[model samples]
Target: MRLSEYQVRFRTRDLLAISGPDDFILGEGRAVDSSRMFEPDVSPYCFDLANRSLVCVSTADISGATFFYQAQRQYARTVIKVPFESLPDGPASPALIFSIGRCGSTLLVRTLEAAGMRAVSEPDFYRQAACHRPLDISL
Candidate 1:
């Protein structure tokens, strides 16, 4: 199937970039506006309740959009409600490291990688969500 000119130009950016929760406002199932970017989207990637992981999918095809790797820490925070906790019942002692910005976190990660330890970094979904929502409005 071929895309129309309007559709081709209509950029499909992430929900955060284009719209907010109120954009999906409805009265008796009638949409107030067709142009608003956000609707009550039920994307699996947005929130995985079962796995307790919020996945942000940013496409590379869009120009000037925030890339996942660039805002790794912020994106990590957006996906959750509670402060991150360690897995209590795990067999091994998980190496949890924290540092201020510009410190050697990257170097530490690299060193761990060199030592053959699998290192998982920034899951900042909460921060990303803050950036997405309208600051003036209340949730």
Candidate 2:
């Protein structure tokens, strides 16, 4: 899909769109997730102002866009699945809110999300990282 001008602007301001090591894991199809590999250096979410959605584009793509280099996403690119072991540990959150059931934690997260912060509510990665284990497809 051709990126809109607004999307370009959003990407320009995205803190996570930086060139570095392989911090992403390509899934079965077109899905990909940031492993928080470059923790504390960059965030994992790209705040899309136009769509109000969080999107993750490859760092190479961001580089291309920044430097005016032409590299199409649909071209013959190496899509690699970064191993879980390669992912670096995420940084400790500066602020964490704990609560019982039906608490406002979700609201807080959503509010942060709306303000262009990379906030997640009860992310599965927390459990996976806590156990120091990768995900099992069978489970």
For 1-139, candidate 1 gives per-residue lDDT tens digits of: 1110111112223433422221121223212232121222211123222333333322222212233233321222121111112112345776667566577766766677688785533323334454554443542
Give candidate 1's TM-score.
0.32
As a whole number from 0 to 100, the lDDT of residue 60 in candidate 2 is 36
Q: Cα lDDT for residue 51, model 1?
A: 39
CA lDDT of every candidate? 0.32, 0.34
Candidate 2, residue 8: lDDT = 22
Q: Flag regions of model 1 displaced more than 4 Å.
A: 1-89, 125-139
Query: What value does the lDDT take at residue 42 in candidate 2?
Result: 27
lDDT of 2 by residue, 1-139 (tens): 1221111212122222332122233443432344432323222232222233233233332321221111212221223223334345556866665555476765776677688786545432233234433244432
